[model samples]
Target chain A: MIPPRFHGVALAAGSAAGAVALAILGLWCAGFAPLAVITTWCAGAFGNGTRIALSLQEAGPLLLTGLATALAFRCGVLNVGGEGQFLAGAALFTAAALVLPVVGFALPLALGLGAAAGAAWAAIAAGLARWRGVPVVLSTILLNIIAVAVLGALVEGPLRDPATTAPQSALVADVFHLPVLVAGTRLHLGIVLAFVLAGVVWLVHERTSLGFEAKVIGLNPAAALRVGMPVAARQMQLLVASGAIAGLAGAAQVAGVTHFLSAATTSYGYAGIVVALLGRLHPVGIAAAALFMGLLDTGGRACEKQLGVPHELGDVVKGVMVLGVLIAAAWAARRSAAAHQGPADG
Target chain B: MAELVSGVAQSALTAAVPLLLAGTGELVAERAGVLNIGLEGLILAGCIGGFAGAVLGGTAGGLWLGVGGAVVAGMLVAGIFAVAVVYARVDQIVAGMAVNLLAFGAAGTIWHALQDAGRDSLPSGAGFDRIALGGPIVFDQYGLGWLALALVAVTGWMLAKTRAGLVLRALGEAPEACAVAGIDVLRWRFAAVLACGALAGLAGAYLSIMRTHSFAPDMSGGLGFLVLALVIFGRWRIGGLVVGCLGFGLIDAVQQQLQGAGAAGAVSYRLFQALPYLAALFALAVFRGRGNGPAQLGRPWPEER
Candidate 1:
């Protein structure tokens, strides 16, 4: 039998293989050759410096959002409002950047405020869950619609770029732009920060007492409460922290890539949940999963351009992968339970 | 003022049809213990499926074909969700979310493929004609609207009076007890999910064919989630569901009218558009702790050998 420590690694590898196989099968059903799709996907995702840079660029927001989801899931809080939190951060960041004087420190200050705005937005759901007995899952989903509406209103009114007919905000000054890590490529320092933040998250989650308390709450809330842990307070804190991380992702997207707020931004928050689940809610795993999803995004576009495949193929693959993980995890849990209880229980 | 009032009322009925259909379906599923969060995706799949089928048939009869395709598409997607949640014992919420993503991607890909294949424009007059019910304009509606109302009545009766309804409700509250009594809890739950998918699919078809006359990506929006909230707001009863749906529908209809009345500059139309969602959120907050949800809701039932 395989050792318990390697179970995570084994599951990851197994699910990854299953995902690839399933994607190939799906492509074949759509009339594409399996071998050609595989080659094309690989080459498109890692073909050149520019391609890799684009993939990493896409991975940045995903990494932050995935980290947000991971932290929340670890604490047993289903914070599905990552999308709303991301939008809140982007909206606040844009408003702050448009008004604040162009300075080196202004960028960080605006990002901080954006994160705070996300935290505040998330606190509303937390408050509702704590006091009013509303489910965070449902409330956050509703809040996402409201957040979108708010963003739409802002862009068309206060944030409207007067110079253009388009319904989007004015671009932030170049001083607020994230510095390029590669001189000739679009790779920005935001990705570097994302990597650093992932490491920090991993350290805190694995080493800190706070993380321990959160995990206990996740595994069994009643047991944690019995142990005198402040369950509600910790859940509220983790949820806010989760929102802040997702908000940072939105803020980074504004300063690093888009430079303005618009209604047509990518659904990074929703995609991040897929990443977190695929990564098994572990920090390092989330980082890798983020990159994998980034590759799918880039490669899917490449297939669309080169072949006739749709770019949405990436979403299909990601969805299937997460489902595969869920099934595998459940099976593993049952198997281990049976093993622990010996043959008689089975 | 009478014309305006009737116009708003007519629009409210139109808006409420899709919600009522999907809400009724979700109510049954929730009562049977499966909270299918993938309702949005199922609706989206139905939109594309119905649109494609209608386009293929290219006649009045295509409307029926479109609806059939929608029901089939919705059930197909929900089938995956059912397998994962009911058979594989996956977490219902996570499985539902995955199903949503899968449906979203599949529908989008199919739409793009259709566009590429030169099926770009939607067929004109692809919807059912309004039938007069012997009153004002408010009494006239598409055949589906009347059918939706009938569905609510039938479902309410089925839940209240039928042995099948009792078994279904029992499956939600105490599956273990049902299992002890030799009931196939898994099979019943699976069927409940499929039924929800079919109804949600019908709702989607109503949106595309009867209401909007065209399909757009993610057109179902958060209507599925709103149905979930409304189901709760109604206190898990048919009467409550109808009242909640009509209330939200009136708010939506008024919001649209206000937007069309050139209130854009004075008050942003986005705020009006957000009213239904905000109202639902407020209702949820106010009606908290008054839920009559099934006891086994969202909990996966592990089948014993």
Candidate 2:
């Protein structure tokens, strides 16, 4: 029998291999040489310090978003509103940055407000689910649309930069920017914070009672309730907390990358779901998945520029990876169940 | 004033075609115990495929060809989803989302390549001509819009009267019982999902060839999700679904008119654009806890060996 420790590694490796194969097949169908595309993707994602930094920079928001998704899923609350929550966070962050005077703690204050905004946004859906009998899944999707429209309205009207005709807010004050972590690279303190936060989340989920209760609620709500667990309240709190993390991701993007609220911001929230699932809903796993996704994003750009492939190839690759993981996990579960049954028959 | 009212009514019906089509399709799938959140992705696949087919078939009969291509493309994407959810028993929601990402990326890549090859423009005569019925504005509508209405009636009747519909709805309510009675639950679900894909594809084709006459990346927007919401708002009944679609469609038409008028000065048109979604959220909230969905909706059925 395979050791339990080795089983996880094997499953991950298998999923990765399957994903690469599927991606290559997709590229080949589009009339590209598989080997050449793979090589180009690799070089573009990690060949130089600048490329690595770019990849890591993209991974930062994904990490937070992934954590948000993971935390919610672990509590059995499918919080698909990460995209909306992220936008809410960025919008509020931008608003805070615009109003708050530049001070030593201005950055933290902006981020805090952004997180609060995200939490509030999530609470709306949670509250709806709790009191109004609306499903979180459906409410979150609708909320995403509303959030996008709100962001567009904000950027075009109230938040419009009068200095420019573009539909975006004014450039954030330089004082609020995330400090560069490395010289001559786009790396910033945000990515570092993302990693640190991932570690903290891991500790919370793995080493705490709250995390345990959340997991129990996820596994079987009826059983959890029978044991007198506060299923509804706990779910609401976890969902709100998830929203805060997604909001932090958005705030980080504003502080570290975009510097202004725009309608065309990267959709880290949607991509975070892929990351969370691929990471097996574990914090550490999510971090790794985020890094991989970041690589795909960076490499896809390189492929687009250097090999004439569309940058959306990265999304395809990520999609294939998640599908592969889901398939593999299911196959493994079936096999294990069969094996368990075999002993009884013997 | 009469002309303006008719115009708005006409526009509302036109806008509701895609929703009605996709929503009806999703309604069937949900009735058969499967929830496909990948409707957006399927619509996207149809968009690109329909555009390409129109461009390839040339002007004379290109629109019809485009519809066919869209159905095929949507089914192909849906087939991938069916295999994962039906055969592999993966989490339907997560799998559906993955399919969305896959379709979006694939469609974008294909679109870019087509543009690079200078085949980006649609044939001038690709869109459907308006059929004038000489009375109300609704009577003078695009062929596809009329067809969408016909489809809704046919679908509603079939669901209420047909044996196949009974089996499909039965599978959703109690798949194990059906299986015990020697029915193939998985096969029915697979077919139901494929049918949903075909209708969604047709809806997408309507967007490109009939409604807009052009394709853009992610053009279906959140219309797909709105369809899902409409199904719920309608209490999973055909009559309710139509009311939900028309209601949302009217809201959209009004928003468009408001935007065109620029009456709400200093308020960005985007706020108007958000009106339908806001209304959908409100509808869902108002109609909450009254979901009449299938008993086994979204639950994976394991085939007993």
Candidate 3:
């Protein structure tokens, strides 16, 4: 077997090469962007503390979103409705925020209880997948559509700020806002909480029976069933948990960063897919991926504000990197799967 | 009363055109087991390319040029995803989503900065001849509308009555078996996928050149995802694509009709907007049992077993 040191060096070189390739593709045919432009984009993303905090602030919700995606993916459940769940969380949290005078600190309690609310929203779609036997992919996407319309209705009608002439978002009560971690920075306690939860998830997956069952379920549902693991139940729980994490993503974004839910996606849940895949479903890997992507997120905004390179360069990179990484990760996993599985059945 | 029904039918068809083309293409795609989620983005790319082509040429020529542009754009995108997911064996869902993200990101920025700077999507004196068949037989739609209907029939025939169709089914059912049976797995699969991309692109182009007559940022909305859902609901069949589009299109038209039907306030209309997704969910519930899907769907080929 190859030494661990060799594996590290190889992996680093491979990821670097992949990154450079992603940058090139992002600049070239993906759009009519250039290399110096990409350099500027990176600089703007990580240039200073303010920018870095923006990255962190963005990373906070993204981490939760990433965790949700990985959690569902690991359990062999495809929770494509994370986006919808996220919106649901935002709506619920907003409703809580509005009722703060009556609810008091109880609003914060509800805001943090993303798991239950998010689970409920996600369960509706999961029911379609489990009971109805519709593909998770289709049902979740459909759920997203319904969720958007629902959100739009709330934002424009019932939940309208009453302060604005146009479709308006209500300002969240301070009591409902996530406690700040760093003064003068948008960096909220949510980042630390998100990481802690991600850590717990990783431990739960790597060190627990459920994790093994989840992996087995993912590897082969048929085999997993034969092994007496309840595949449907695990998938159901995983999806609900995924929804909760995704809901937390939305809640954190609104409470910590935006201080309100906007009509459009603040891009929390969607960006999580890239982080989850790039991290290869590992907790630490997710943090690193999120930071790297957080830089891109910041940088994309920078390019738009400064170089006039258009924020899309970052988007192109995000897409290429995620898609390319998925391909690479899949290939690597496939190569290792043979060796990894040999001991199991044998 | 009759006019109301006919008018709703016409508007529904208009909305269904792009969905028809994109859904038809997705039908070809998922049959081979690749769930392309980036359709929203792919259609956006087509909208951009199609608009550019239409602007460059005059009338009929520009229209056909737009089709060519869309096909090329489709190929360019479908080619990348196939390489990543098929060759590199990436997670198809995320890979496809990434493509969509990239496509969506670029279209607005590129159109405004690069293309519009050169007057790209702007109408350039040339466009389509609005066909006046002048009767209940076929009065409302332009020639492209008629062509879209023809495409549905043709694609259905190709899927059912052809050697290529058989190979696609065999590959979908069992790629390894198809390979063992001496079918060129990559070639047939790639052909199906690229065709999906091209048709999706054509659908996107149709939005700009035929129906709305211009390119707009992210104009396809979530229709790409809707079409994909319809594909699953339709069981990845060509006939299903047409029927699904009509069904969805009717929902959309009816949602708007709810305005005339005087169905409550703005809030209720928002709920009504959710009709397509809710319809799909209900349809899935009614179907209740899973059909035998493509045997090799979502299992990357030469994949680790």
Candidate 4:
């Protein structure tokens, strides 16, 4: 009994370690990766200075996406198209930056406006799900295609950077870029905001009556309605919140990291699904998962540089671990359910 | 306009061929009460496996071999999914997702290995030769085109006419009721989902080999998702499903046309590409998930107690 309790507290950690072990098994399957290289991949991710910063910096946006997915999913919304919503958010940010003339100390205004636009764009699909009973998964994914097309249309047409002769949007003014936190550190203000948001999500879910409502709706829609909750309104609000968080994630990616928009380079939105799932849909868990994934991502690139294992190898490892973790969760859930069957009524 | 219209029709036919195959397979699978969500990943895995086989073996008949290889590869991948969700009694949706993630990673590993090995004797792509019907309208399509239409007709007939189809439909419509009737519901349902996986794989092969010559990693894009949506929009009707395929094809084609017509930077272009999904939404709006979706779409049937 004592051992099981010990294991219970360590359950999430132990399973995560097991997932890593499974990933090692997957790598070994190829018979191409050498042991020294794997060691180097891990070391390079955490041992050095700049590398760690890049990992944390990258995780900032991913954490937001992860949190967005977790919130929506916890509310019983399956948002598979966060990638598209993210791209649309970037597009919205770009559109806003271009339309609004940058004035002195107008930096905050620009970023805030961009985020609202991003939220509005995502709310379109959320609205569809609310009004029409369209599955969030289907609508979001479809919107993803539309997002790509819109970005494609813009880059190829009016938003085309004529002077540079590349299909990049007009770079947002330097004044609009968020201030870096520590001069030598890659820690930007965005990372801080992500932490704050994570706290806010936790508080909203734990403290407020709204949290109970969201949980009820997610757990059972019919039950929520019978309980006199405005299921539709809650869903709309949750959808918008989910999209806005995802939008900020994409906006942060653009304003924080790339500083330029491209349909091809980034996909933090979809990657967030993996993060959220890995984190088990808990806000703090998402933060940790995003950072871990960000470490793996950084490690993957390092492996490409140091060991010739290719960046895709890291992606392979990620995909494998995700499956491993999910399968374990499924079995665990099933077992728990079976265990609680009241001893078969004696 | 007529010339453009004809061209759009032809393009839509070409685009819709694989979707018709995959969507029909998914239709059958869902009709038996399982969502089979790993379809996108299944198609990718099938493409990679089929591509690997065709490329590794310098066979003269690449298309036939590729199609066969895809079916086997697809069924094998999907078989793993069936075991996890069915026999293991895991959540079908999550199992489908697990299969997808595994397929995606597996396909990536294969692509990297093949590319690292150089083109070598691995046969360069030129599969699926077209049968030119001389004059114009109905005949000069590729082998897959004719096969797609044929498969649609056959599936439609089988679904409406056959005893096996009735058993499958019974499992779909009411698993408990069918099990009470002593039907081997689990086995039949497994067979249906496996069929869906194989057909979807064939469609993936069509994309890499027939549509485009070179096979890129994760080449199915989200066509599988679109086909899944089509299952809804089609209201599970075979004919309507095929029409839905055509409709999606046209939407895609029109989006490209608009890009050609200089709507490139416009947000409307994004909305344009969303046309099919919106159409799917419109469908759910009109039908409201009542008579629209399958009766027992995501549940797995149990064996006799």
Candidate 5:
């Protein structure tokens, strides 16, 4: 019999194999050179310094957003408000950037405010779930639409950049931007912050009582409540924390990458959910998955130039990969369960 | 003033039909214990299918063919979702989101490919004739509009009065009990999802063939999500759903009218766009416990050994 420890590994391996096979098939069907697609994907994702830099830049936001989703998922909460929270964070940070005087600490303060704003946004859903019988999933999706609307209003009216005709916010002063970690590339300090947060999440998951309680509530709220855990509170806390993390991702994108707020600033929030699931909701695994997905995002853009494939095809790959992994993991669980029961039946 | 009022009323009816049709379908699925949130993807696929069918089949009978293609596409997509949710025991939210992402990309790819083939403009075709009940402005409406109301009435009757309705209700509330009573929970749930998909597809077909008479990528534009909200606003009841859809549709009509008239000023059209979603949240928050959905709304039925 396979040990319980190796079970997760088996599932991961199966999902990866299936995802790759499907991706190849999709490329072939789309009339692209399958082998060339992979090579170009690799080249555009990480072959050169510029590509590597772009991947890291992409990974920075994804890391935080992925962790945000994974943390909530681990606690049995399907918090789909990461996108909304991310936008809230970016919007808040931008608001601060416009108001606060440019100082060394202003960037950090804006980021902190962004996280708080995200938490506040998420708290609306948490509050509804707690007080009303409204489901978090429904509320979160609703909140995402509302957030998008809010963004549109801000950019088109209050935040419109006078110099540009498009609906975008005014760029913050260069002093408000994050310091470059690597010269000649776009790598910034936010990437370091992302890794630090990942470590913090890992420690909390492994060593903290709060984490234990959250996990317990996730597994079975009734049992957790019977065992004296604050099921409701923990659920709220985890959702808020998830929102805070996503907010940080949004803050990073604005301050480190875009230097302005717009509709597209928080696009990675949905992709981050896919990353969290792909990483099996583990902190380290989520980090790895974020980077891998980051590579794909960069590579997808490259396909436009190299193979004339639409960059949105990358989105298809991401969706298919997630689906493939989920199906494969389910298959593995069923197979293992069947195998385990064979001897008993005999 | 009379003309404006009729125009608004006509627009409201046109807008509400799609939401009503989709919401009613979702109501059935929810009654059968499956929450199929991939309605957005199914609708989009239907749009593409309906558009393609109409263009290729020609206008004489192309509209109906387009709708048929949409149903097939929606079912095919929803079938994938059903297998994943019912048989493989996948997370409903994840599966739904994944399906949406796939639909978004797939539809875009097809749209772009069509553009490459020199069909860049919106495909021109015959739309449903507007039948005037009272006057041209007051009651002139697409046949699809009438068809949607008929579907709502039919769904309402089927769910409330039929024996199959009782079984579906029982299955949703207590799957184990229904299983003990010899009902195949999986089959019923699968069938419910397909029905939901077919209805959502019809809504999509109506959008492309009747309302716009053209196809645009991502044209559904969260209409699926709006329908999901309407289902909740309706409290999962068909009668309430009709009211909810009509109310939201009126709001949408007014928003568009105001935008067209350029009266929004500082509020911005985007704020008006946010109104429907905000209204949904407000409705859900205020009307929390008035109408309860099925007990096991999203729980996957465990396999019987």
Candidate 6:
């Protein structure tokens, strides 16, 4: 008999393989050369230095946002407001850049403010959920709509770039921009920061007592309350922290990739939700998952450029994989539950 | 000014119809303890199906065919969701999110492909013509709008007075007890999801066929979320849901008017556009009463004894 851990791993691997097979079948049915498509996708994602850099660039925000989601999911609070939090973060960052001096430590200060903005945005939902019996899921979804409207209003009004016709904010000073870590590539300090943050999160989840307490709360909140733990407070804390991480992701997008605020940055927040689930709520797992999803983003673009496949197909595959992972995880949980009680006991 | 008020009211009622349909359906599903976040995705799929049906069927049977196709498509997506959440017992929120993403990506790709295939901007079909109303007090609106109101009345009666509704509500409150009473909880939940999907589909069809008269990618534009908010705002009652929908519809109509009048200059039209959502959030915060959801609204049914 397979050991339980190996059984779980095998089921996960199988589901992933199934998702890929289905995606390939879809491509084939669309009258595309599946092998060539796969090759092009791989090349675009990882074949060269430029492609690798692009993949990392895409992964940077995904990593932080995924971390944000995974952290909240670990604490039994599903924060679906990552997009709103990210937007709040970026909007605040832009607002700060508009007002603060652009030199000497201003970037970090503004980024922190952006994180605070995200946290505060998340707190609105958390507070309602705790006090008014409003579901965080519904409130967060509404918050996202409100945040997008607020962001658009700000960009078009107070933060509009007078120099360009496009609806975008004025570019922050060059000094405030994240520095390039690798020459000849777009790889920036944000990617490094992402890796460091993942490591820190891993330590927090695996090595700290707070993590243990969080785990207990997540497993059974009622039991935690009975044991004298502050369940509501812990949920509020996790939700805010999750929003902060997502806010930092927004800051990274501005500092590293876009260098200006625009509506285009909203997709990463939802994509991070997929990434967190795919990573199985583990930090190290999330890093790997983020890179894989980043590869898909890059590869999807390559497919659009080279093979005439719509780039949205990559998003379709990601969505399917989320389902695949959820199914596999549920099946494994059931199997383990059954294994714990032998058939004779029944 | 009187003309403007009448026009705004007219537009608000038109906009409110789809919300009423979708919100009423979702209210039923939520009453049965299934919070379908995939409502947006289902509506999107319905939009595509409805548009294609109208285009293919043309003037003679176009509208009916489109509405039928939309209902089927909505049910199909909801079927998958029901199987995953009810039968497989997956996390409802995650499952809903996956469905939304899937619908978004699929619908957008299909839309782009359709454009590539030279179906770019087919002229709006003969959408529902407005009925004559003698004065401003009368609703000079599409036939679909009246149908939606009739549906709201039916839903209200069914939920408040029917035995089936009581059983469904009981399933939501205590599935174990209902199961002990020999009711198939999962089956009823599955049915609730399908019905919700059908209404969402009709709503989407109304947008494309009777409202916009054209299909656009993500045209639902978070309207599904808005409907979800309306369900909560209305406290899961049809009367409250209609008021919520109309109120939101008024906000949306006025926002459009501001844009059309160019009166929003320097004010940022997005602020007006976002008022309903912001109001919904604010309302959720300040409103203190008996919360509407079932006790076991989002929890998975416990393991079989």
Winning model by lDDT: 2
Which prediction has more favorable lDDT, 1 or 2?
2
True contacts kept of each: 0.79, 0.83, 0.80, 0.39, 0.68, 0.73
- Residue-level lDDT tens digits of model 6 in A187-298: 8998999899999988988899778778889888989999998888988899999999989888877877778897554578888898888888888778888998888888
Q: Tell me the spans in candidate 6 whose CA falls farther than 4 Å from its real position.
A: A1-3, A6-12, A344-346, B122-125, B128-138, B288-291, B302-305
Give one digit per residue, the lDDT tens place, for model 2 in B227-248. 8889999988899999989988
Candidate 6, CAPRI quality class derived from DockQ: medium
Report, for all candidates in order, the number of backbone clashes: 0, 0, 1, 4, 0, 0
Which segments of model 5 are wrong by more than 4 Å? A1-6, A337-346, B128-136, B303-305
Span of 10 residues, lowest total lDDT, candidate 6 chain A? A4-13
Model 2: what is its DockQ? 0.81
RMSD values for the candidates in order, in angstroms, are: 1.8, 1.8, 3.4, 3.2, 2.3, 2.1
Where is model 1 more than 4 Å wrong at Cα? B125-127, B132-134, B303-305
Residue lDDT tens for model 1, B132-172: 78899999998888888998899899999998899889988
Q: Score candidate 6 by lDDT.
A: 0.83
- State the lDDT of candidate 2 residue by residue for A1-346, as single tens digits: 7786656556766786777787778779978898888899899999888889999998999999999999999989999999999999999999999989999999999999999989999999999999998889888988988899899989988888999888999999998899987677667899989999999888888899998999999989999999999999999999999999999899989998889999885788999899899888988788888898888888888888887887776677777777888988888888877887886663
Candidates 1 and 5 compared: the better one by lDDT is 1
Query: lDDT tens string, model 3, B131-166?
Result: 656786225776667777787788888778988777
Residue pair clashes in candidate 6: none
Query: Which runs of model 3 end up more than 4 angstroms from their true locations?
Result: A1-39, A102-104, A333-346, B58-61, B115-121, B128-130, B260-264
Better of 2 and 4 by DockQ: 2
Between candidates 3 and 5, the one scoring higher on DockQ is: 5
Off-target runs (Cα >4 Å) in candidate 4 are A1-15, A103-105, A182-185, B1-8, B88-101, B120-127, B135-137, B250-289, B300-305
Candidate 2 global CA lDDT score: 0.88
Worst 10 residues of 4 chain A by lDDT: A2-11
Model 1: per-residue Cα lDDT at residue A77: 90
Greater-lDDT candidate between 1 and 3: 1
**DockQ of predicted candidate 6:** 0.71
Q: Which ten residues in a row have the lowest lDDT in candidate 3 chain A?
A: A4-13
